[model samples]
Target: MKKIYYSLLLTLCVGVSGFSYALQDAKNIMESVKYRDQGVDRYSDVDLIQTMSDGFVRSRSLKMYEKEFGEERKGLLYFTEPSNTAGTGLLMYSYAEVDNKEDDQWLYLPALRKVKRIATNSKEGPFLGTDFSFADIERMRIADYVYTLKEEKENISIIEAKTENGLENPRTGYSQRIVHVDTDKNIIIKDEIFRQGRLIKVFEVVQLEKVNGFWTVVEAKMDNLVEGGSTRLIRKNTQYNQKLKDGLFNQRTLRKGLD
Candidate 1:
């Protein structure tokens, strides 16, 4: 009996140690992805296509600008196509200081001719009638989640993440996310979003290439499982580390449209 008891205890110890190491490895991988240096500024023209359940498709075009300021990142997006959405714009500022402060977001509606601040409670709403939420477009902070390695394949590592450190918004759409990371490149290739323990959406990186020494996703798709629809975002004419004006990301620029 003594010999059998010792063997079981030894096995349990090894299992626990392996689990701890896996968790640490998953966190390290996520940190690499979150902190990867893209560039100081980036500009891109994007095509947004939304496919409906009844086989209808709508398309729009957007001009996007991004810049890094200290630890904060600013983004501006302006619609350029579909006449009706031509002047619609969104401005966002993501802060590195995580002290219970939410990110800043603003929307400019051409019909209203005004800029409206997006409240934290409404960040979970679909972005411009697309499959992506406002929160999805913002930068993700590493400290906001606890990650564990679920599985590791030869080319990919699957990590399950749960919100921590008061990072989850009460009104957010997703409760947890399962991410498939490219082990070699340390980039997120796919994500499964769960809402109340039910899988609601799947996001996939369909194409990726290195742009100015940074890995960039050129084509991506988001499928809404419950809604029976999908949205595809394709990037073209991408330029990185450009000299974008600081004033372009402000609300004034959003309302006026990029000069």
Candidate 2:
């Protein structure tokens, strides 16, 4: 009985140590991906194409701008195509620290002629009929999730993450996510979103290239596994470290089309 008790205690100690190491390593890998310097500011024109499983395609033109202030990142996106959506805009501010504070988001609807604050609970809703959700566009805070290293490959590392208690977004459609990161570039190459242990969506970086000293995804796709639809975003005319005007990210500017 004494020998059996000692063996069990030793096994438990090893298991606890292994779990702690895995958690720390996962956190380090996630931080590298989050804090990898892109630039002080950026601007880009992009095409958003939504395709149905039936082969129908719809496209929209968009202009995006992003800037960093201290540990906070702000971004703005405006739609310029499909007369119906022209002048629609979205503004976001994400913080580096993942406290109880929620990111701020706003949407300008051309038809409504008003800029509306997007509720934090609505983060999981589809963005303008696209497969991508508002949460996907906003920067994810590392503290909001607990991560575990799933697999390590020659060039990619797979990490499994789930929302941490007290940091869970009630409206988030994903209960967990599996991410494949480029070990060299610290960029996410793919993500599989799951709800209740079932895969519901897949996001993939179709193409990437080094632009202005940063590895940029030139083309990406988000597919809704259960909905039978997908959205592809193709970047064009991308400029990094540009001197973006501060006012461009304000609700006032969002309501008014770019001059």
Candidate 3:
């Protein structure tokens, strides 16, 4: 009778521990989404125009200077033109939280006068030349993805954020990502990419100094362990909640500037 009682107690304890862990995982995932959503919402508010503008300026100015073979480098060699870049440009979009959609466009080939619409399916591809993918631009609601609490220890909740079609690959198909959420900041501080349940890539982000009172991503790096190559992206300007002009996002505006 004593042995039976002890066995039951142990089983009960295990079940309770599992239940607690599941609940905590749910909470951690929820918190991660909440924090990201709040930050994005705040970023869209018009009240942060000044900060946004500052970030824009700094981001545009971020560049690496390199001397040419014959010393021809002089001005604006490292910084991209934004309009002519292959995968990057000034993002002009309107966020629709109520509808869970984003109306966004990109301006490329300024010399030819072209503006292209951003498709929902292509959100997972890299943004411009940076390591950031288009999905990184818009914010998603917390309830959109299914959450699994993978681990919990040392006051840190380990969550895996998985959504059906979470990552869209234009050329291939969809990809799955397991993100490690930082409970303290409610941010997805790290991620491991898997394709068909096989490890493929690892992504990391480092928080830098605040720009315009908003927590900004200072350095981001993505490694394709299988490909033997990596990309590093760094952002200097990060401003939130600024008034944006309607025409500024237009293709014509991209060619004409803020005139």
> What stretches of model 2 exceed 4 Å from their correct place?
1-12, 165-168
Q: Quick one: ranking by TM-score, best first?
A: 2, 1, 3
User: Model 2: clashing residue pairs?
Assistant: none
Query: How well does candidate 3 match the true structure, expressed as C-alpha RMSD?
Result: 11.6
Ten residues in a row with the worst lDDT in model 1? 165-174
Q: Pick the candidate with the highest TM-score.
A: 2
**Per-residue lDDT over 29-136 for candidate 2, one digit per residue giving the tens place of the 0 to 100 score:** 889998888899999999999998898999999999999988889999999998998999999988758455788999999889888888978988989989999989
Whole-structure CA lDDT of model 3:
0.49
Candidate maximizing lDDT: 2
Clashing pairs in 3: 43-241, 48-241, 49-242, 87-128, 88-128
Model 2 quality (TM-score): 0.92
Model 2's alpha-carbon lDDT is: 0.89
The count of residue-pair clashes in candidate 3 stands at 5
lDDT to native, each model: 0.87, 0.89, 0.49
Residue pair clashes in candidate 1: none
lDDT of 1: 0.87
lDDT of 3 by residue, 1-259 (tens): 9999999999999999987878666755665544443222222100000112123321233232111112111111122433344222344453434555544545354456665666766766755534345555444344445567877666555666555566633322335566766665565667786666677767777554555665555676666555444555555434444433333434554455433
Tens digit per residue, CA lDDT, model 1, 1-259: 9999999999999999999999899999998887678789999999999999888999999999999988788999999999999999999988875565678899999999989998878988999898888878877766657889999889899999877642454546566889999978878999998877789899999999988888899999999898889999999989998999898888888767776
